[model samples]
Target: MENEQKTYRIDGFSCANCAKTFEKNVKNIKSVENAEVNFGASKITITGDATVQQIEKAGAFEKLKVVDKNQPKPEKQSFFKKHREVLISGLFMLLGFALIIINDGQNAITTGTFLISIIIGGYQMFWTGINNLSKLRFDMKTLMTIAVIGAALIGEWPEAAVVVVLFAVSESLERYSMEKARASIQSLMEIAPNTAVIKTPAGNKELPVEDVRIGDIMIIKPGDKLSMDGVIQSGSTNINQAAITGEALPAPKSAGDDVFAGTLNQSGYLEVEVTKNNEDTTLAKIIQLVEEAQQERAPAQHFVDQFAKYYTPAIMVAALLVAIIPPLLFGASWATWVYQGLAVLVVGCPCALVISTPIAIVSAIGNAANRGVLIKGGVYLETIGQSRTIAFDKTGTLTEGHPHVTDFMTYGDYDREAVLALSAALESKSEHPLAASILDFTESEDVEYSTIHIDDFKAETGKGITGTIDCKIYSIGKPENFDDADAYQSEGKTVMIIKENNTVIGLFAVIDPLRESSKAAIEKLHKMGSRTAMLTGDNEKTAGAIAGTLGIDTVYAGLMPEDKLDAIKNMQSDHKVTMVGDGINDAPALATADIGIAMGKGTDTALETADVALMGNDISQLPFTVNLSKRTLRIIKANITFSLVIKLIALLLVIPGWLTLWIAILSDIGATLIVALNGMRLLRVKE
Candidate 1:
């Protein structure tokens, strides 16, 4: 009486009363100890460990996520659930075989049992088939059901039984596999943190994200993430926003940067200035849009819907002809004609073919999720597979996005390495804006610098850095700060020019480098029948230099926010185009593309704007995702073809008396089973 207990996070809740209803239903468990639910939390906390499977079988969405007191992680798929669906279908197969072998060459029991199995295994499907047909439309299920039953009525027990069993098993496998595949996208909605910490003048507070409002100050400390859309009015650090921008490196952030919630602050501390509440946060919107887009459906899914509508009615008519015409028109014995008609019905069921497409797509979508690639659903999965062109945002998508000193042009009294040594010496002591520039130059080019002793140093923010190095005055500053306006061209990026003994030395250009994986990913995509293009607001020169370095096919330079969308539409008209960018200004373009892939390293809003979001900003996964989509689509088509051909040929043979009823039923079930296993092969497709 004091042992069992159960708990769950029940969603779509109406009220506490609804929770009570679930609690009451679950309390019936024999071993259950006690069930305690707090409606405010939307979760039931159980006292003792208990089996919750029975409750799950009571409803479709009522999943049993946890089985024990502590709410165990999702349980493994039950063994009973896996093989149990085949019971009725398997019985039909066994009955047809038994009738052929055990019953005398002409016995009533054999025929009766064969029909009984058909009735039992396919009764629901038979009713559904008729219902769909009665609506003046036919689908794959209707066709299969009509053929098998038509065969059975003609006394072809073997064919009738096999046809129904085959349809049943195939449909079951398709449902199971597709649902399993969709688990990936579903997982996104599952693991998202729903709560946020609210900051108040009276210390710190933990509250639900919904309770959070705009303009609230929140303390975002070490190891804590922003819970609402906010700005950094105070504090600074490097944030690893790979989940948003798909840029793996942590972006250095300071005051005034609009930081989003759900992005991890890898290091440093910040007092967040809240801009938007939970509803408007990047994560919520991304989840919402992805879901909406997934449900919108694609143009291709209609193909199957159309095929199923006509195919069913047409096949039923064929089965009727096979059963009734031969004896009436050709003088064949009633038993032989009926048996052959039965064979036709069994083999002609198109259940496998009908379900193959969605199952494969759903599975691929799910598979991408497992790899941290959030493909919205079958719709986006199919689009990605069909893409012939890919547009990449250069800043964070194709580059390291970490601004580092790359090339240094030297000028005066100091040799290249001497100027580097002198600058490193004086700049090392100052906490200035250009410190990263100096450090990057030394590390990247193997430039060795001896210590330049500094006696006097000074820095002016938005101006430049100056210091005494080894009894000499050395300074590296922007042109505007040096009172030397004509010394060098602006060169676009903030240029750092060196001046020693009042003479201009060298100018060093600083830019973030391309990611190690970007070049390889571009090459691989080219090999996979996709051309790569770059879209950036960067000027023609910088964009051109990067394009040449990476060998990208096209570059759209000086593009404003709105222009990106038009660019995407142009590419999309001829070849399916996939847009990859850091989410933000790229939202419209991402939405316009055939498939929008957002780098996880940026804003949640940006990630939400696309069809697919990468969790790891590694460019390598882009190739992997595209290839995975193609592979999944290929498998879906193959499975559909395989299932359809077997069913059609089997039905065709039955009318001509080439196939026995027993052979028809076995072939139908066997083909459906094989198609299912083949579709599952997608789960194994890897980069």
Candidate 2:
């Protein structure tokens, strides 16, 4: 039988390099067919058979622990406990310094104390580095190990000890930053309750979410967070959906309304019928997608990885020449040149450069997820940031998606209420799409039409409906039957005529209204230097009206699916265009655009197809996502540039032979910390 693939949480990784090492080691296992480590998520996936003990042993160099991915996370250790080895090493180093001062020079006791400190603090680094060295792998660990061992062989005991302790501290700092970045996903995972109060056949019993099947009724009370994706079967409430949509306001929900797991029921009691299993819940899918997103390498990350692959070996060769050439050509002291070469090796660790892009990518994606923007990958994030044009699908994207009565006018001898009441009563019996709008309008006007009854109702396709009310004949139908229909159609409204005994009495003009946030969102996009366009299947007039109202730069009206795709392709000829749509109907255009953004309330197809999802279903999040993506791109460039510049400056110190082990290691540590902290700033980005 074939072994199934599984993913497990991993602990004890100190840096991205360690994660790489662990992943490589796991892949080397005899029974494991494949292995991948998600450094940002601190999780490992293995294909084929591998026992927990076997996987743990693969990471033994780092004392890595493997746990079930679904298990509750272990409580955090205190700083001292977490860094015990480094702390112990530091204590011994301090003792060595004390001894050196007492003796007024380097001696046996101080040397032994420093040696103990180095062994304690750098054993893992040395072990992994030496193992990698044997295999001709020159990762950061191998470079640091070679540098530290060289420093010791040259009798620089105190500096070597300090280097070891400082390196460990730097790795610790890297781990902490990764943890902080991962915390966004962790917080999301913790949002929904683990169990739910299930209404069972025997009695109401609280059960684990996984044990609750579809059709199970979940009882949620005020202040309770829903534990399943379900529909409200009974009662009503206001739900705070910040966990799912990042919307601050509490949404009102009544019977038959949908509710998602992780959302809080702010008021009222609800018996919700479960619609999805625990692992299939929207929250679960978000967590899964976010984790998968972290695993994808951005274009910048690919460049950095390739650069580092060549860069590390080049540094080694340069260091070799620096050590031998000066001594052979100019009769410089071998010890001095060799020491400088080792310093060069230490300076070229690539700690910061290796992490510059991924940390930033992780931070940005995690932050976006927290804000209810599900950016699918770093590539999408970068594309969105670089996009110059944003194209929107008109109906559900920019408009209310359904028609509403926008204008009502009455003619001679008929009062507005009397005409509305008769029309509403007649239309209520018709099953046309426009009928709902008429009934909705009547309700909004507070007209007593529901109590009015219609008799002898007859519908005509593409024409109108006729009925008798209060012993009088009433007719409502397409505006083509009325002479004054041109005025409404010219304004992009659907006109319906109401007549008494075949004489026009009133007219109802309907149109799908724009979303309240659409205009402001478009203006914000324009201010941010993005040009906007609209693509719709609606006629030229309707599409032009909406485009004009929103100040859009271009409009592609009467577009079929292929036409929308062609429009996107055409737009790409001039600029990078992002297609924003309801996801299903716009899939072709979305797939063709530079980036695809879908409204969260859209179908599952939308969620899976789009490069990004605005969970609030409001375009207001569009400008925010663009701002975030642009900011993330800027920060990534800054991080890579800063890391390279710092390395260049440190390497230049070789001109005067001013570079020392202390200065080289400190530069690496400083650059690593700066890059990490800078990447973390994405977490603070707000709308």
Candidate 3:
């Protein structure tokens, strides 16, 4: 039989080392085939037949609790309850200090109190560390355990007790920081209500969203939040889609309009037909993707992991040398040099360095998700921040996508309405991109063209269409066949001419207008030292006009899908390039670019293929995303530098025989706290 796969949310993980330890222990289980832990997200995946009890036992060193991925989270405990062991140990250590002051020296009572404190506070650490030491798995816990035991052997009972209590407190603080970073995804999961008022065949009934099936009708009243992704079946209303799109305005919606789960419906009742199940909703997918993204390691993170793999063992050897070298060869005191060596081991813990990159990535990704930007992983985030040029697909990306009839002019004996009606009559039978534009214009003018029947309709690819109305032959095609056609084409409009028996009657000028945010977005990118380029299948004249208006640095028009891909390749030779498109038509180029960004309203192919997604479908978010990525990179770099610098300073103290257990633990704790806090600043970034 094949191994079953299961994922669970894990609690009580304190540090990256502990997470690794838990993962290793689980993989050692007899029935387990493989196991992996996402420390940043505090979740684990296992492929085995191991029971929940078995998994929990594997993580018993940290007292970890495991629950099903879909289960409700357990309630939080009070501070005192959560830190009971640490608090009790601290009390005992304080009592031991008082007894020493009263007795004027170390006595049986003081020694016993300190011993009790060490056992209580360091129980888990010692258990895991001792096991690791036996296996020769040198992690932070192993190093700390060696240091504490050495301190006790040297008759430094008070210092050992202090080390245990301080280490426990530091671990708690690290755990709290991780939880704070993970809260962003947790908040997103709570956006939509679990139960919805679904209209059944018999009557309306409220049920869990999981029980709601596709095609079921949901009755949503004014001021109520939508519980599923669906199309409105009856009535009209304005929906605030801020939760999904991050747009401030409420979009007016009516029958036939699609609505997403977690949107607020304001004004008018609605009967919505569910289009997707609870797990398949757009909001749910966002949460899932964000959680998965946290597991991906950035380049800096990989480097740090590789560095730490050898760094700890190297520190262990160095400490061992410092402990014996001076006393054996240089005539130094064994007790003094050994004490310095133990302090070196404590200072060498890589807690801060191990967490530097992941915390920043998690916080920045979460903040971007909240602002309607989805960065697929840390690599893409880093690439986007470093990209010097961005290439955009013109249609649907920089424009409104659908063309509109901007100008209508009559020639010979035809009037504007007559020409529009005739064009609409013939276009109603055609399947061209511009067909809807003529039909819409005819309806707006009340031209009554739909009643006319077109006969023998013939469509000529890349040219025009021909048909008969009232037994009269009529044709609509490119205006280039007629005189004065250059006038409209010069202005970058697509001109379609109507003719009767080869004589031109009238013409319609259409253009796909630029998006309101396009020019401003392009300008913002330029200001940030990024070059902009436009790619389109449109004519050179039209593409140039649009590019000029937006101040884009380059334009590549009249290109096929393959041509766009080639263009991206060319741009990559000199600079890193990002391709932005609607995701479907631009798949080849999007895949070929250094980074691909898709519009949120684009097809499913775009959402899955692109490296990043602008969920608001607003180009303005592009600048904000770029800014956030750059800031996150800076923070990660700063954290790594600060952590190493602090560790280096603490190690140098051993040269003058000034290093002590108190200073070493304080340095480690201070570095961990500083890096965690600095990384968390990413969560405050806003658009």
Residue 533 in candidate 3 has what lDDT?
Answer: 95
> Per-prediction RMSD in angstroms?
12.4, 5.1, 3.2
For candidate 3, write residues 441-535 as lDDT tens digits: 88988898867888889997556899988888899987654656666666767778898888888888888888899999998898889999998
Candidate 1 is scored at a TM of 0.62
TM-score of each: 0.62, 0.89, 0.91
lDDT at 102 for candidate 2?
94
Tell me which residue pairs clash in candidate 3.
Answer: none
Per-residue lDDT value at 267 in model 1:
83
* lDDT per residue (tens digit) for residues 505-616 in model 1: 8666667668888889999998998898998765566677778878899989767667788889888777888898876557788888888888874346545567788867
- How much lDDT does candidate 3 score? 0.88
Instruction: Say which prediction, candidate 2 or candidate 3, comes out ahead on TM-score.
Output: 3
- Residue 496 of model 1, lDDT score: 67
Candidate 2, residues 1-687: lDDT per residue as tens digits?
777889998887777878888999999999999999998888998998899999999999889998764677689789888889999999999999999999999998899999999999999899999999999988998998998999899899999999899999888888888888888888998899999999878999999887999999999989999999999999998998887787888899999999999999998999999999999988888888888898887899889988988999999998999899999999999999999999999999898988788889988999988888898888999999799999999877887778899899999988999899888888888886678999999989999887888888899754689998888888987654356766676677777888888788999988977899999999999998999999976556656776888899999976767889999999999789999988776888988999999988623565698989988887888999999889999999999999999999999999899999889999999999999999999999997
Candidate 2 at residue 392, lDDT?
97
